[model samples]
Structures are given as structure tokens and as C-alpha cells.
Target: MAAAVLAGAAGSAYVVTVVDRPKPVVVSHVAEVLDGETIEVRDGDRVTRFKLVNVDAPAASECLHQESAVKLAELLPEGTPITVVRDGPFVAVSTQDGTLVNAALIAAGLAVPSVNGTMFLDRAKEAHHSAAEQRKGLHSPDIPCTLPGQVRAITEAAAAVEAQPLKGTKTELTVAADTAKTAIGLVDQLAKPGGLTWDAVAPVDQTVLLAKVTKVVPTLYRKEAELRNVVKGLR
Candidate 1:
């Protein structure tokens, strides 16, 4: 649990707040997909940010960024109104099979955990750690960016951090910091624009973190055109 918390603090894990909205259909509208795991849901013209659970997709410049998005569309189509529910502070939706596939994305190397699990959401962090250890690939902020093939990204990242001096070499620290930041950013990018598989958010064990997605407007979500231009700068 301590390791998991540290991992989360260093951007290795995502923290999600459960939304206790008891009344169903409290918010309504169409949602737009931003990347693999993030989506913007329109509720009477209000844009709400939703983080997809389980899965993690690459960022705009990451090797699989667009590919993940395309695959997500293939798996989940736009205009598909899924059951949307409030899971803590986040808005959650259920997958077609309703197995909390959002977290599965991280397991599948498609996305990373977005936030650390709070007291109300610690289970999420534990689940993520278990999943990360299981995959052995897909490095998180706990480690540097690595492939699922490596199967040692976490240990390797941990080693890297251990060897670096916290107050010594600025150059070394910069390198270490960038590597970690990249890993964390990758995770966040995937979490957003993430939603239920445009299917349903239902009672998946009645857990607060695992809310079902009811319905949503389907549309491919790219960043605002203006922000997209900023991405070009990164390239």
C-alpha cells in the first residue's frame, strides 16, 4: 500500500474521486472522445471532463496515440449513448460487457492510471498496482516509458530513481524528471477523453468506483483546434 501511494504521488498512479450523484441520469448529453481514455460530455452545452478507467492510451506524439484513438472508435462508436453514472468525483460509464474495462486498458497497455485513488478510491490504486505488476510492460511514472515487452519497466524505473541524487547533479535530475513526467503525462493523456464503451454504466458490484455509463452523444473528440496547434509545437 505504501509503495502504491508513493507510485501515485510520483504520477505513477491516477487519483479519482467518486461522484455520489444518487439520482440516475442526473446529467445528460452527447460526449466527445479526446483520446483513448478521455471524453468530453456535453450536458446542456456544458462540457464535462471524464476519465476512462482501466485503459491507458499514448499521448498526441506517442507512437500509438492516434492508433489507440482509432482502435477505441472501432471498439466504441460515437453516437452510442451509454449509461453514465457518477463514480466519486468522476463521471463513469459501463462497458459493453460491464467488466470495468477502463482499468483494463492499463492492463492491455492502451492507457495509464490518471490519478491516485483517494480514501474513497484507494481500491483503484491497488487495482492499478496489481494490474501493473501483472503486465510487466507499459511503464508508469513509477518507472520510465517502456514497452509491455520489457516486463521490467517498474523495477527499472525504481532503480533509476534510487540511483539519482535528489540534491546533487542537476543534469541527472533533469533527465530523471523528464522521464518520469513523460510517463505520467502519457497516463493522463489516455485517461481523459475516456468513457464507457458508449454502452452503459451500470451496477458493477455496486462499487463506488465502478459506476456504469448510461448514454452519450457519439463524436470523435480531438483537442480544441487551437490547442491542437500547440501540440504541433511539441512535435
Candidate 2:
């Protein structure tokens, strides 16, 4: 973890926190395509599996899973060299043909956005929304997509936090922080095994973060109101 303090032109102090993350391990050459979002690759002499980050495709038994797999196969055929990068608990892929595989999959409507946080969250959301609007792939009129297990848990956690009392005091801030931390733990626990399937958890992580943003808004407003009252009294 890294921290820095900055002073603005107006003499306001801001504390910035940064987390140092290791570079993702890039694996070259695809050995196999397990499904829509999972792949096997050659990492030196050993073969390992890497999950695609920030996208969740249908499971084998679910509707459109085969279609999703077929689409992926078309995009990345056998022996097609590709690059895989593992970022923290998630993995991302880039095809030899210059395809940002995660974003591509979402755009094609082959998968929905995962609940976990991703660097490409905005792009993925736009793609998912477009696909949904057009009734593409798994988002077809007859075939609705189901929220992954982890996504469901995080959504519920966000709802629970939103339902809490907002007293707009230091106590409320403490409560909100604790609740948000608990939600993070719950999300971590919900992550599935296999690096590729891990992308399934990103969507809800993003959701929980947004919920926290909403929760903090009231506290900020309360503080601003108190400050205004003090200024008025002085005047």
C-alpha cells in the first residue's frame, strides 16, 4: 500500500492512497479453449488455466452456452497464439488478431458483465447494455441471462447496506465503512475457482462500490449543511 499527501492551490490538504500491484503474468500461445470464458495456455512447459476477466458467459448447461463457446472458438481457434494477463484475482486476454477478448465477448452479446471490478468496466457496461437493448445472444427475448452466484451475493449485500440508518454523523461513517468492508469479504468468498471463471465475480464488486458511493453522499451533505449553519451564525 502507498500513501501520498497533496496541498491544493487553495491550501486544502488531500490524502491520496495508492496500492502497488504487481504486473500481470503474460502467457503466450493458447493451448485450448475450455469454454466461452476459460482457456488453457502453455506457460513454459506447464499447461495452466486462465479465466477471462470482467465477463461471465453462460455455463455449459445453460442457454446460449454453446453459442457463446462457438463464438469464442471462431474468434480464437485452436493453436491461435494469444496473450493472457493475470491481474490480481482476475485474468484478461488479447487475441493475436488484436481483439480485446473480454470487451469483444461482451459486445458480441455472448456474455454478461461479471460482478467484480475491472479496468474496462465502462466499456463492458456499454456493450452489455447495447446487447440487451438489441436482444442479442444470451440476452435474447426467450433466453434471459441469470446472475452468477457471486454477483447475486454482492447485489444483496449492497441492498442491505443501503437499507441501514443514515444518521449522518461520525458514527454513521464508522457504520458505513464497516458495512462496506463486510461486503468486500462477502464478495471475495463468492469468487469461483479457475482464473477464467473468476471474471464472473467482477460485476457485483463494481455494484457494491457504487452503493458505497451513494451511502457516503448523505454524510457529505450533512457536513456541508452544518458548515453553512456555522457561517450563517457568524454573519
Candidate 3:
């Protein structure tokens, strides 16, 4: 057994319970701000780098990345006390005052919930929705980032495909193929009759609309692959 001592009021002592193991994880002090979702921490003489869990911030070159980084820095400047919990390759960070850095980032619209997040995944998503509703940070209409409109449209189409019997069922492969076709049809309908011209949309909406095509195309192609597999398996 190992006893860990935590800082407290001058006359008070706080004993932390720690099991004796070959290697132990220790709470570290924030040493440097790496970016919106990454930081360097120091524990005694050892320094380590970790990415905050449950949130995915935009890249440095992407819109709103600098703003996101600034927000995080304001929340956790160097020497701030923080605790970290290992989550796979990354770590979840929380302030000594019990503020969750991950949730804070999402709630402020500085980051989105990671698709592969483990702990507090649903909470992060909820915070993201709240941020969007409030038009905070990058979710603001004037932020000039890719909007979620096309993302929502693609999500609806993907959900429609999932509603069908794509997986194991009594339904025939032809039915699955038809469902995939329907999903792709939804994507086609997103394009206006005028050929989705750049000049047609407002300047602000142009980047969002054009950028989403790359994102939506991959989802359509995945459904197309499923259709091809259904045809091949029918033989």
C-alpha cells in the first residue's frame, strides 16, 4: 500500500489511497498549453503530453482553431492543478475545482464530441447541442466555419439506410439494395435544380455547402458498397 498526500489548508492533511503497483498514474500539474485539446503536464521530474478526451477540436489551420485554443488556455493556464484519467491513448482532464475541461470545450462550441469517446460521451454530445442552440463560439452564425446543415442531411440519409434490413434478416438482398438506392437518392435531392452554383448561395454559406460535398460523398459511397455486396451475395 502507498499513501499519497494532497495539498490542503495549512493545518489540514488529506491522505489519498493508492495501491502499490509496478507503475502508478499520478495527477500532474499543467505545464504548457499545446492546443485546444492537448497539453503537457508535469509530475515531479517527469513530463508527459496528453490529449483531452471526449472532444475533437479543429486543426490549427482550420477555422475557429485559434479561438478554441485561446478558450482552453484561458480555462487552464500553466501551473493550474488538474487530475487526469486515462482513456485509451488519451486522457480526460478535470480542474481541481471539479470543472471538466472536455465538457467545457464542447459546451462553449470550441470542440465537438469525439466519435470514439468513451466516458461522458453522451454528455459531451448534449453539451454540443446546447452550444449550438446558444450560438456560442464556433457555432455562431458569423464564425465562418462549415455549418452542420449538410451534415444533418447526410445523417438523415444514413439513418434511412440503417432503418432498412441491411444486416441479417429474412429480407431479400434485393430489398437491401433498394434501401441503399433510397439513401443515395436522398443525397441527389440535396442538389438544387440550378446545379448548386457558387454564386447562387450567400458568400458565408458557400464554404459550408461546398465543403460538405466531400463529407457526404463518402457516406453515399459506403452505401453503394453495401449495395454491391448485397448483389454479390445473392449469387
**Residue 52 of model 2: what lDDT?**
75
TM-score of model 2 vs. true structure: 0.49
Error of 3 at 8 (Å): 25
Best by lDDT: 3
What are the RMSD figures for all models against the true structure?
19.1, 18.8, 16.9
In order, the Cα lDDT scores of the candidates are 0.42, 0.57, 0.62
Which whole-number lDDT from 0 to 100 does residue 99 have in model 1? 26
Query: What lDDT tens digits, residue by residue, belong to model 3 across residues 1-235?
Result: 3222222222111112223332235556789888988989899988898887777887776557888888889878888887776656776676766566777777787787776656456656766777767767656645433344434555555656555555554355456556556646555655542321212234465566546655656656676577567667754
lDDT for position 114 in model 1: 54
Q: What's the CA error at residue 62 for candidate 3, in Å? A: 0.9
Q: Once superposed on the true structure, which residue ranges of model 2 sit more than 4 Å away at CA?
A: 1-24, 142-235
Q: After superposition, how far is residue 107 of candidate 3 from its true place, in Å?
A: 0.7
* Superior candidate under lDDT, 1 versus 2: 2
* Model 1 misplaced stretches (Cα beyond 4 Å): 1-21, 24-31, 42-49, 53-57, 87-89, 116-123, 126-235
Better of 1 and 2 by TM-score: 2
lDDT of 1 at 140: 29
Candidate 2 structure quality by residue, lDDT tens digits, 127-209: 67766566556544343332333344445555655655544455554555455555565544434334323333345544664
